[model samples]
Target: MSLPPRAHQLHVLACHACGMVLEDALDSTGHGRCPRCTAVLHRRRPNSIARAWALLIAGLLFYIPANVLPVMFTSRLGSGSDNTILQGVIEFWHGGSYGVALVIFIASVVVPCSKFVILGLLLITVQRRSAWARRERARLYRLVELVGYWSMLDVLVVAIVAALVKFQSLSDIEPRSGILFFGMVVILTMLSAMQFDPRLIWDSEDT
Candidate 1:
C-alpha cells in the first residue's frame, strides 16, 4: 500500500507555539521562524540522538552505585547503620510503614529502572528504523516524560523525613552518597528524554 505524503515533504510547517502553518524549505541549517509566533522551526532537533545517547549512558553508569551505596544513615543512640535504597525500602516494609515503603519502591527503584529500559528501547528502535509498533513506542516516550515529573519523589521524601527527625534528641537521619548518585540518575534520564525527538519515530518510513 502507498503511504500519504508527510507535511515535511509538502514544505508545510506548523508553529509549535501558536499553531501557525507556514511553507518553507528544509535546509542544512534548518533556519526559519514562524511569522506569527516567531518560533524556531526545525525539521528535527540538532544532535538529538547523540545527546540522548550520552545522557542515557551516564544515567546507567550511576544506576549501579546508586543502588549499591548507602543512601542514608540512621543513628539511634550511639549506634547506626548504613542503608542503601533497597535496604531502606525493606526496613520500611518490615517496620510496618507499608505506604512509605511502597511509595519509595515505586519512585526510587521501579520508575528509574523503567526509564532506563524504555529510553533504551526507543533509542534502539529509532536507530534501527524499525516500524514495528510505532504508536506504542511513541506512547512509551510520552510515559517517560510523565514519570519524570515524579522522579524526585523519593529524594523529597528522604529530605522531608530527615528534617522532621532532626528535632529528636536520640534519632537523626543523614543522606549519603548514594542518594546524590540517584539524584544524578534522575536528572540525566530526564534530560535524555528531553533531548530525544519523538518525530523521528514517524519519519522516513511508513507504518
Candidate 2:
C-alpha cells in the first residue's frame, strides 16, 4: 500500500504546540515560528535519539542507588532505622497498609523499570529503522509519556510523610540519599520521553 504524502512535501509545516499549518516559505532562518501560538517548529527534534539515550542511561545508573540505599531515616526514642524503597514497601504491606504499599511498589519499582525497558526497546527499534509494529511502537511511545507523570509519586510521598513526622515529639522522619537518586531517575526518564520524537516511527514507512 502507498503511504500518504507528508506536510513538508507540500512546503508546509505543522506547529507542534498548536497544530497550525504554515507555509515553508515562512521558515526563512531554518527555524520557524507558528503565527497562531508563536511556538517554535522543527521538522524533527534536533538530536532527539542521542539526547533520549543519554538521559535514559543516566536514569538507569541512578536507579541502582535509588533502590539500594536508604530512602527514609526514622528515629524514635533514641533508636534510628533506615528504610530502602523495597523495605519501606514491605513494611507498609506488613503493617496492613496494603493500598499504600501497592501504590508505592507500582510507582517506585514497577514504573521506573517499565519505562527503562519500553524506552530502550523503542530507541533500539527506531534506530534500527524496523518497519515492524510501527503502529504499536507509536502507541508505546505515547504510553511511556503518559506513565512518566506518575513516576514521581514515591518521591512526593516521602516528602509528605517526612514533613508530617516533623511535629512528633518522640519520632522524626527525614529523607535520605535514596530519595534524591529516585527523584533524579524520575526527572531523567521524563525528559528522555520528552526528547523522543514519535514521528520517527513512521519515517521508514514514509521513505
| Candidate whose TM-score is highest | 2
TM-score attained by model 1: 0.88
Residue 182 in candidate 2, Cα distance off native in Å = 0.5
* Model 1 residue pairs with clashes: none
User: Where is model 1 more than 4 Å wrong at Cα?
Assistant: 1-5, 16-19, 26-30, 167-169
lDDT of each: 0.86, 0.89
The positional error of residue 189 in candidate 1, measured at the CA in angstroms, is 0.5
Instruction: Tell how far residue 129 is off in model 1, in angstroms.
Output: 1.0
Candidate 2 Cα RMSD after full superposition onto the native fold (Å): 1.9
Q: Let me know the TM-score candidate 2 reaches against the reference structure.
A: 0.92
lDDT of 1 at 90: 92
- TM-score, each model? 0.88, 0.92
Write model 2 residue lDDT over 1-207, tens digit each, in one string.
976788777888788898888787655776667789988888888899999999999999999999999999998976889999999899999999999999889988888999999999999999999899989999988888888879788889889989889746588999999999999999999999999988888878755
**Over the stretch 14-63, how does candidate 1's per-residue lDDT look in tens digits?**
77668777786557446788778778876677799999999999999999
